[model samples]
Target: MGFILLALGLVLIAEGLVYALAPSLVEHLLEMLRALSEAQRRNAGLAALALGLILVWLAFRFGV
Candidate 1:
C-alpha cells in the first residue's frame, strides 16, 4: 500500500511538472495522441506498459 502511494505521488509530481513547465507542450502532445487511430493508441499504451513493467522489474532486481 505504501509503495502504491509512493508510485502515485511520483507520477503526479512528474505530471504536474510537465503541465507547470510547459502547458503548451502538453496540449500539443494530447493533440497528437488524438490524431492517432484507436489501434495506434492502444499499441502505444501497451508499449508504455511494457516499458514501465520492465523498469519496475529492473529496480526490484537491482534492489533499488
Candidate 2:
C-alpha cells in the first residue's frame, strides 16, 4: 500500500509538471475537440479511453 501511494504521488507530480509547463497544449487539445462534429468528438473520447487503458496496462506490466 505504501509503495502504491508513493507511485501515485510520483505520477501526480509528473502530471503537475506537465500541467504547469504546457497548459496551452491541454487547452489546444480541448479546442481541437470542440471543433469536431459530435460523432467525431465521441470517437476522440473513445480513443482517449483506449490510450489511457493502454498506459495503465503498460504501467502494471513494467511494475511501475
Candidate 3:
C-alpha cells in the first residue's frame, strides 16, 4: 500500500511537471491520438486496460 501510494504520488508529480512545462506537447499528443481511426483507438484502449489489469493482478500476487 505504501509503495502504491509512493508510485501514485510520483506519477502525479511527473504529470504535473509535464502539464506545466510542455502543455502544447501534451495537447499535440492528444490531437494525434484523436486522429487515430476508431478501430485503432478501440484496440489501443483495450490493450492498455488489459495491460493495467494484468499489472494489478501481478502486483497483488507478488506483494509489490
List all candidate RMSDs to the true structure: 0.6, 3.2, 3.1
Give the per-residue lDDT of model 2 (tens digit) for 1-64. Answer: 9867986898899989989999999899879878999999889889988997898799889996
User: Best by TM-score, which number?
Assistant: 1
Off by over 4 Å in 2: 1-30
Best by lDDT: 1
lDDT of each: 0.96, 0.88, 0.92
Give TM-scores for every candidate, taking all chains together and pairing residue i with residue i: 0.96, 0.55, 0.65
The C-alpha stretches of model 1 lying farther than 4 A from their native spots are: none
| Model 3: lowest-lDDT 10 consecutive positions | 2-11
lDDT per residue as tens, model 3, 1-64: 9977987998799999999999999999999999999999999999988998898899889986
lDDT of 1 at 64: 66
Model 3 ranges off by over 4 Å: 1-17
lDDT of residue 25 for candidate 3: 100
Q: Which candidate, 1 or 2, has the higher TM-score?
A: 1
Comparison by TM-score, 2 against 3, better one: 3
